[model samples]
Target chain A: MTNLTAQTRHHLVTARVENKAGVLLRVAGLFSRRGYNIISLAVAPTDDPAFSRISIVVDVESNLLQQVIDQLDKLINVVAITELDPEEATQAELLLATLARSVEHDADLGVLIQSAGASIVEMTDQATTIQLVAEPTVLDDFEEKLRSYGISELQRTGAVALPRLVQL
Target chain B: MKLTGAQALIKSLEREGVEVLFGLPGGAILPVYDPIIDSSIRHILVRHEQGAGHAAEGYAQVTGRPGVAMVTSGPGATNIVTALADAYMDSVPIVVITGQVATTSIGTDAFQEVDTTGITASVTKHNWLITDANDISRIVAEAFHVATTGRPGPVLIDFPKDVANATIDYEEPGELELPGYRVASAPDERSVAAAVELIAAAERPVLYVGGGVIKADAAKELAHFVGLTGIPVTTTLMARGAYPDAEALHLGMPGMHGAFAAVTAIQRCDLLISFGARFDDRVTGRVEDFAKGAKVIHVDIDRAEIGKVRRPEVGIVADCRLAISALNEQIAKNSAAQSRDRIATWVERCLDWKQRFPFTYEGAGTAAPGDIGRIKPQFVVEELRRLTPPETILVAGVGQHQMWAAQHWGFVDPRSWVNSGGLGTMGFAVPAAIGAKVGCPSKMVWAVDGDGCFQMTAQELVTASSERIPVKIAILNNAYLGMVRQWQHMFYEQRYSEVYLSPDLPDYVKWAEAMGCVGLRVTDPKDVAAAIEQANAVNDRPVVVDFRTDSMEHVFPMVPAGASNDEILVHPSQADQPR
Candidate 1:
């Protein structure tokens, strides 16, 4: 039997769309209709307010990536798209993990926190919150460690990426 | 000077050179209808909104203009949905204007309220909801542009009641600017060169023509290209008349129920030059194995259709006219075009297939001199084809009869045949034939319908009779959806599965008489010609001929739906007989 850990690839796609109210819905609706799961989606104002840039990370079967692009290209609101391959793009995710204060107080937790590349953002007698800013893999590892400490709250902002440049 | 949005809509249509429109007036659309009463554009009031939409399609198909339909919202809008989807599926250019509830009542679901745009979003080529009076001219212009351009499909513009009632100072619409929808340019030199290179090298090559050639108005270019290349061609169902059926180079339609020679040639060609045709499921059965031996060259106006099915060795994105013209020029320059004697054996085989499997009905040839009763559907279609002129427009209601009509009729020129090909819409013939006659008022129009299909939207004949549109209707009354029954017989253990319809129920003759049309029921085979001639003689009103045909007849040379082209089912009893 195949392992339950699903084998999928994350694709980072950036699109320029009209800043109208229904634009986002139409785009997301397309993703759902085509059966592509959006791992994370972020939209922000670009240089021109008339249009905004939407960054989406989707986990899909590798063979179906071109079909997704083709489908997206047909949507009228989408003006342009640039797909940054995982290896060619610089990527990062910001994740906040809140854990019980008992873990921080017990077993030299300060060294573990420093070594794990997590910074404390807030602390109280009962709870402790730490922020991790790093590559997606590093963030995933930190979240896995926080879950064992009986975490009270956990928030992960999906990956945001830009194409990495090599000097000419 | 300011004009209300309704007046502006009519004025804009007039400016676009629209001579007529087909529709019905209802509560939500009364404001627009008021302006239309005095406008030069003639409104052909149809019995149903679906009829109106189909009539518009018929007009567009024959005249090569964007057919226009108008209707009220809610039920009126929903009724016309089939026409929009039909036009969409067939890639026929039509613009539909519909009334919506007042702007304030849109979300509140007031009287005759429906989200017309939302319902039609997927089916339409493009759609717009009018919010301001000033937006009419631009939106109308855009709708026409989008409807007629590219692959050419239906466009709908939803006119809210309040917006139509509002007034604005209208100026002439400016230049067309479509940011997202761009008209395709001619294919680059390399792709055209590559296509020609394949054509010259292959010993067995066939030009697979389709409706896109007719849609592009490229029949002349296609003829010129084929003439210069000296290559044999096959037209699809939607492209019945795109090429002259009388020509020796013609291989007839190629698909399910298509010519044996044409389907076999597609299966065996060394190089398949697919000009302006999508390899639809019907055409390419067992998609993985279609055109097993051919190096395909797909040229279309739509880029998405290129790799959407079978990936071609060389794909060219350009208008059919430009692409074929370019290929012809390249063939003229290159020494690659093969000589006539080079592929003589293959051509001979195709000619043999054509002769061996000519579309025929049982007892059609050896009938006794004065034989009467139990008319064969193919026989009726052939009789109609022989009676009609070269320039006559033939439309069909979808069923076994539609297939038979396409197979038997010798369509001599482009834009001479119109049917619901992609959508296979039942009850398409009468209204569409009305639209065709309206578009070309001087030409003879004939609607070939099936009994099962005719019952769906036969009310449109009333519209034709009232409008004084004299067209001929030949209902092959087999008393069943013959195609469906044929399938049940072939594959489903002959269950017959609710496919039969009783003849006395509708009484087509009485139905026609009630609609103010002269109805002729022919039970005898010998009287078929005389009945058709009598129908032809009448020019003041429409005529319906209820031809009581053989109930067991089936469209042959069948691909059996999901089966491969090689697995065609020939006529059962005549399997061993020579053509």
Candidate 2:
């Protein structure tokens, strides 16, 4: 059985695919059927309207990375695939958290949020919604700190990545 | 021209030169069926959707064209799933068109509605759920293109009821817009040169061929290469007829249930030249230990399959025909005299093994010690082969009977043998035989099936009878799930499980007669040839012959599952004999 935890090695695969119905399903279906764990996934239209780029963080054994790439490459809708190495790629994630608001929670949380590069997006009588745009690891840390303030709801937009600009 | 999506679908099929299609009608697919009636293509109305799918596979295998199957939504779509998976596993080209609920009601739990595209996505090479009638022709063209190209497999198009009913200006699809889909073209010159070097250097080499050779229509090229090099060739189950069985350099088959010489030669060979054959677990036995000493030259059209199993020393991603032609060219240029001279002793040794450890059964003409009123399946298969025309197409169901038929029947022509090799789907023979017979009406087709397999989809014989297809069927009725029973007998200390299905129950002859077939039952080994001759004589309709074979007879030269090929078990009688 494959280890599905986050601690296992994660391969960030970015696939440019035709922007068509059921293409995402086909891509996701391949992963599920093959029993490969998806740590995270993000999809959006690329610069070209005809194609969409899907960023997938797959938790797989080291030896199976080639298989993951090969299998993904077989999908008819997938135009191209590139494994974005962490050192050579830039990744970003967005995290939103709705936390309970009170005098007791407000003081220390403000300092923590500032240090973590998070901002208060919305404020209400009983709750405060915070937004964080950072690397996945920083987002994870920011989300963890918000947990102590009695979180009501939270969501993370999975990481999206691109190759870093090469120095000429 | 203005046309409904249904009309466009039929026109597209006509443009694709589809002569016949297997299908069943249902509410959601009624619109498409309406157009099929007026189309030039002959539509075979199969009794069940599964039969339709398998029949399409049969047609594709024999004709080298993508088999077409159509079925309705929901239950009908689900029924064909097994056949689709079977085609996917075997890389048989087929296009399955399934009806879906109207686009408006697709997710509203409409009547006879299911996610046909989603259900089949994994099993198919590619699939589409049509939303526009305008795109019907293009999708159909693309579907055929995908199904028949690069490691050909099944493709599907889920046609919704509204889309079928909608009108549009029908136009031929432009050049296929599939940028991502590309087949392996000519191999790298470096890889080809490297492979040729390996071929010229290795003293002992075995040419491992698979079904891809048949798919690529490369048997002639493969034969020419083998002839030039004098390399021993072993055809896998899917490749039984790819290489002529009577060739001097032919090793029968490799892997589990393969000929001893074939399996042992692969184990002992120094060079394993895999031509279009995936290193399937069934062929490799145990991956780590299979051909441990051999350097591999793997050539296949599917890039994913090349290094997916065994890492080859020289991997060439090219069509088998092209790859073989390239190798032959290089070999000619290199003049492999030293290689041929060095491998002479090795070739002689392999041929000796082939002559000595030939497939044999104990008491072939008589029953085993305590089992009276029974015939050995091998004898029945051998007699069937002898009685039938050499060019006859033999379709086999999965089990001991299938192995028996494969071992006993000598196939010389390509596409003469069709069996579910990769998936090992039982109940495949009956419908597939029907399809093969329909595709090649001039040829004699026979479905050599097991009783267990016969029970699964035997109703398709009724379609055969009603359509006046004269495909013969030989049911090796051993009154048990023969293959599973053999496993229980060998590894499970003879603790028989629920493998027994009484031979008398349902009375196969009566069942055949009920289905409008001329039924014959053979209890004596002497009567086997007579029964087959009688079946062959009846050319008006299908015939079913039930040969009451011994349940105890197991397929020999068995490489125990997951065991090393070096430890292959030969026949009990041949066990412990001097090498």
Candidate 3:
């Protein structure tokens, strides 16, 4: 009714392409060439695959966003394409780990982080590592709460999502 | 097949295409020097170890290759840490090789021995202490790979003396095995769509571009995005020349000491799209209030930068070039366009702000009756800009002169404008100029310095003259560290610290003359041009022009420390009477 396109919470796009040289160049080239920013991407080979499957998470309008899928399909090695919605399909998770400097020295801080769904992964004299997997906002809140405990270093892997149902 | 660790190091360097090294010779690193005699690698012996580090920075900046510098352990390595830090902060790719005391001497508090690895850990991207001869080739190869890859930065390899002398079968350099690190090239599409939506909806938008664009070579894509969106763009100090100043939408630098128009536009924007920029303190003054009215969208290659400061309304952790292109596609498909009148209104407001607070200097109103005929710093910058060709690389000593150069000079190429932007190190320009001249021998390199900064490492003039590097130095001799004194005068109630060096000036000029270089002193404003001309004429040897500038003149458009970007002390004009 507003005439403006309604924004979706998230989008999932799967691209199957050759795992050859500059395949990255072509894929990245397509996105950057179009001025698109991918939020989360999981790239790996499928079970029957001579080709690689690239799962891309992007927020875009339905019509123009379909063009990206078509473009990915046009790549010489690209075999197929599928766009998934988090609300309808299964969800994937992204893992983030941050090394905390003190644990026993800051007991309440450690308990507070665990409350945010982060588990103590590793502990050493210099630092303790806390691992978390959740929505981006939860990760943000977890990192923010742990800051008072002093974070020495941090690392996060690309988001990996799967369909909630096993059916293809 | 057996060779000394030092020999393997040299061989690995040769394979890496290293042609020159800048460093000082010391006891621990003598073995490396021995191999240098036979190798094709040329070593430029600097007067000081620190000069060697900055020289490497200069070489790295110009060549886009990893600059190599060699130094001995202990004081030698410590001396070069400031330069290493400068390279680190600026993201200059440099490979620093230092010699440690022999293996047996470890933890003995041996003479001339210090923990070079520990000393440089924070300053280097990656570093290793090679205790075994067998690990030499692998470590050297990995150092080069690490230094030149991803976001290029300085890497160090601390070679123990005994390890350098020890012999083993040398293996050829192999593929680098860095499993944890991979430079992100593709953008996440969801983030791109969100950014496009924000861009399409916003009435007043500003594109804040930073050095990451130049580093990733995404200038063309960035320009195209700006063109399509018709959004005004502002760069951080490091991102100068990414978008040409002559471009219609380019608003120059923003934040503390930035253009008044840029700061005002950023403050008034409805949305701020940050591309490849780390929101540094200097750029984002008091982060909480910065762009308070806008919905911030930050796009960078590094995920660590997303929520570091001033939480973004939409944070896209992807390469700017890729992200912008994706967003452009979405916008094109949707055909979502904002009203042209809104853009026009913002542009008119920006123009009005520029007119109100123009950056200018008016010669102290014909000079006071008893004025000592001091040269104005602005005149020095203007004269240098006039005399030099557009391609001339201007390197500056950190302080008032550096900021003045940044504000005044309109750089036309990426990497053409180089400075220790965040580090703000004094005594940087001379050696850096030499390195720049060495890297691009055909181009004219000018080392702009202040009297205070020039004296810090002015001894390198001897090295410059001896090497016949032909770096023309224009020293803005205000006889005081102008920036510090300005802060003291404005904020500290004029209680000047040890900033003056008047009576000691004669000794420095005499030293320059003694070092086989021509030294000219300019007191009157008219003599400034003639002195610069004379320095240009002496191309065979390095020339130093000492322009005695006014001690009281201050750099305007200053956002004092802890102040918001919107608040700036604009230069006093004719109507506004000076206190």
Best-performing candidate as measured by TM-score:
2
Candidate achieving the largest lDDT: 2
lDDT of 3: 0.77
- The per-model lDDT (C-alpha) reads 0.86, 0.90, 0.77
The segments of candidate 3 whose C-alpha lies over 4 angstroms from its true place after superposition are A1-168, B320-341, B363-373, B503-508, B574-579
Candidate 3 per-residue lDDT over residues A1-168, each given as its tens digit: 112342352467867665543455556666775666676677877675566667777656665566567556544345566776655555545555555465767778677766776777777776887787775545656667766766777765555555566665
Number of the top DockQ candidate: 2
Better of 1 and 2 by lDDT: 2
Docking quality class, candidate 2: medium
> Second chain only: TM-score per model?
0.98, 0.98, 0.94
Identify the CAPRI category of the predicted complex in candidate 3.
incorrect
- For model 1, state the Cα shift of residue B315 in Å: 0.3
lDDT of 2 by residue, B1-579 (tens): 999988999999999999998999999999999988788899888999999999999999999998999999999999999999999999999999999999999899999998888899999999999998988988999999999988899999999999999999999998887988877878788999999999988999999999888888999999889878999999999999999988999989887999999999999999999988999999899999999999999999988887888889999999988988898888878877235787999999999999888898887534432144568888887787778889999999998988988888988899989899989999999999999998889999998999999999999999999989889999999999999999999999999999999988979999999999999999887788889899999999999998888878899989999999988999988887655
| Ranking according to lDDT, highest score first | 2, 1, 3
Off by over 4 Å in 1: A1-10, A21-45, A56-64, A90-168, B175-177, B366-373, B573-579
